[model samples]
Target: MTAAQYLNCLQGVMQREWLRFFQQRSRFLSALVRPLLWLLVFAAGFRAALGVSIIPPYSTYITYETYILPGLCCMILLFNGMQGSLSMVYDREMGSMRVLLMSPLPRPFLLLCKLLATALVSLIQVYAFLAIAWCFDIRPPLWGLLAAAPALLLAALLLSSLGLLLSNGIRQLENFAGVMNFVIFPLFFLSSALYPLWKMRESSEWLYWLCALNPFTHAVELVRFALYQQFNLTALLVCLGLWLLFSLAAVLTFNPQRAAVRG
Candidate 1:
């Protein structure tokens, strides 16, 4: 296909995915609600219970709610990425994914189209969550809101590539829930999401390094810095590197004959 034709097909698939996402009201609302609940109810109740030190990018005492908004946004991308991949797995079982895989187009491009579609959906949910955060007086600078766009796009690619890795690895859907719980929870908590690396260092040097080493931590930091209208070079580089690496890995593993010869 010509470049325009290929792009048009990509757009068509993405539009279909978006339409289907909206049609499922529960899925749509759940995406918005989870982050809101964490920001409003969960963070509010725990704001005073947790004492935090002044970390870079933060001055005097800040509420926990304000601190974790970016983290919660990361959570939305993380969950939505995996959820989208799970949907793909279900489609495969129902014979739809096979048709998708067999499309008269490059397999990697098709997979990327799906990933981009999922990223768009994830970004919508994140922006909605950010709007709700504004109502509660939990917001970053205006520039942060603008900078968050690319940060989120990178995060989506990182998480979506992870989802692609998982979907291609795990042939069964029933096993996904356990993987989600194990992977998502640890990745979120162990990172500098709710706390700073320095804070984690005070608790445990090991924990501090672990957080520093985690790519998600970089993803969160990139968003956090962008939220404050500051550019974090290291965070940006780390996130970009991981996005490229994971996406390449996902494409490699998704090849039909990678493991066996075709008949």
Candidate 2:
């Protein structure tokens, strides 16, 4: 395809997603509510119960709301990624997936565009959550907000790619319940999103190892350190590498034909 053709496709895909985002205004509010609920209600109780040791990116002991903000930020992205993939299943049923793939553009590029569009939408919601958190006094450095943009985008992409892989790999068998049970919660709860690895180790060595190995943990770490204006080379490399791998796998194994048949 010509350069203009590629640009047109990308623009169309992104515009369509954004338009839907606006139409379902409740989704945006719903996304914010999850994190805010945890931050305001759950974190408050945990703040007193769990004494958070001083960790990197923290100079002194921090409040639970402050410590959990990054994870909550990620929670937005995490759920958005799932929602985006869930849309893919809808599109497949409606034959939109077939129409999109029938474009003259390369299939891989088209899938990449979809992934990009999803991540872009999620990034906007994440920032909206962060802005609301700031008003509640869970503030990070002002410069950290700027630094977090790229980190958030990367995390969004990584998360969206993983979801895409699951839907694309597992043919239309049943509902998203399998994914929610097996993928989403496990990744979220097992990661360092809520608790530090040291604490997990204090509880169970194996659980700590699992959290350490989870890429979502790295994604959270990437955002956490970025929000403090610090760089974590390990997290940067892990998230980047996995995003590439997962994106590639999703693109390669993309089966619109099978999805269409099943849908």
Best by TM-score: 2
lDDT of each: 0.84, 0.90
Task: Give lDDT tens digits, candidate 2, residues 198-224.
Answer: 999999999999999999899999999
Looking at candidate 1, what is the lDDT of residue 43? 84
List the candidates' TM-scores in order: 0.93, 0.96
Q: On a 0 to 100 scale, what is the lDDT of residue 79 in model 1?
A: 91
Candidate 1, 1-263: lDDT as tens digits: 89997989789889988998889989978888888888888888888888777776776677898788889999999999899888877776666776676679998899889889998889988998888889878878877799789889888888888888888877678988888998888889899888878789899999999889988898888888788877889989988888788888888888453323247
Stretches of candidate 2 above 4 Å error? 259-263
Clash-forming residue pairs, model 2: none
What's the distance in Å from true for residue 248, model 1?
0.9
Which pairs clash in the backbone of model 1?
A: none
